[model samples]
Target: MEITEVSITPLEESRLKAYVNITFDEVFVIHGLRVIQGNHGMFVSMPARRLPDGSYKDIAHPITNAFRLKIQQVVLDAYKEIISENTLEKTEDQKQENVAVQ
Candidate 1:
């Protein structure tokens, strides 16, 4: 299965960075994945649901470690690209402000 598309929406809260939606083979879609900042760094959290027992369970996940890693890598790559774009924009804005002040 090929990941046809990925959409990331950035957030501004602690730990949680963004929400992710991925499409597979241009036919299947999965939502509610999260990009989180942990102690080590950023990682992807799979979509999940709250069970009746008050615990959360993954709504969908890869069965194999390899597949899980592949998903994480793809999502993380997209997330990094977005973050870099935002950072570049912010840097440019700062430069413009400095020029204005000068």
Candidate 2:
């Protein structure tokens, strides 16, 4: 299945960077995926549920390592694009403020 779309909601104030939803073939969609900041930098976390035993179990995940890597790459790349755009916007705003002050 081809990934048809990816939607992201960026977050602040925590290691949880964003929430993501990905659509496959423009029909099947998966929600609650996450972009997380970890010791290794950033990675994608599949949707999971907390079990009664206090451990987490993935609710939806790719079965093969290759597919898992594909999902990770797609999610992380989208997250990075969002961050880059936000950074550019903030830089533009700063420049406008500086010009107003001058």
Candidate 3:
């Protein structure tokens, strides 16, 4: 298991994006994430929904203070773990696919 690449894509006027590729055994998962800054320095959240009328609102309880910090730590750790697992799986799959072709 390993991390082949970590990439981020930015949207105009939005916070920086987060991209992670994770592998487990012989399977890999790619995830796209966005973390937005909140009013409090210690708080950050991901917006879940936008009103049709055109208003911004967060649907879930924000990650704030110690909670936000903890969440950040967890996310980082998860990203690392997922990458290794996903890489291994993805590589194996590609190998098999190539073998079958030949």
Per-model tally of clashing residue pairs:
0, 0, 11
Native-referenced Cα lDDT, model 1: 0.95
Cα lDDT tens digits, model 3, 1-102, are 433443433333434424433323345443533534445531224334779989867544324566546545555555446556777998999999999999
Residue-wise C-alpha lDDT for candidate 2, range 24-93, written one tens digit per residue: 9999999999999999899999999999999999999999999999999999999999999999999999
Q: Which prediction has more favorable lDDT, 1 or 3? A: 1
* Reference-based TM-score of each model: 0.91, 0.95, 0.41
Lowest summed lDDT window (length 10), candidate 2: 11-20
The CA lDDT of each predicted structure is 0.95, 0.95, 0.49
- Which pairs clash in the backbone of model 2? none
**Residue 95, model 1: Cα distance from true site in angstroms:** 1.1
For residue 31, model 3's alpha carbon misses the true position, in angstroms, by 15
Q: Please report the TM-score between candidate 2 and the true structure.
A: 0.95
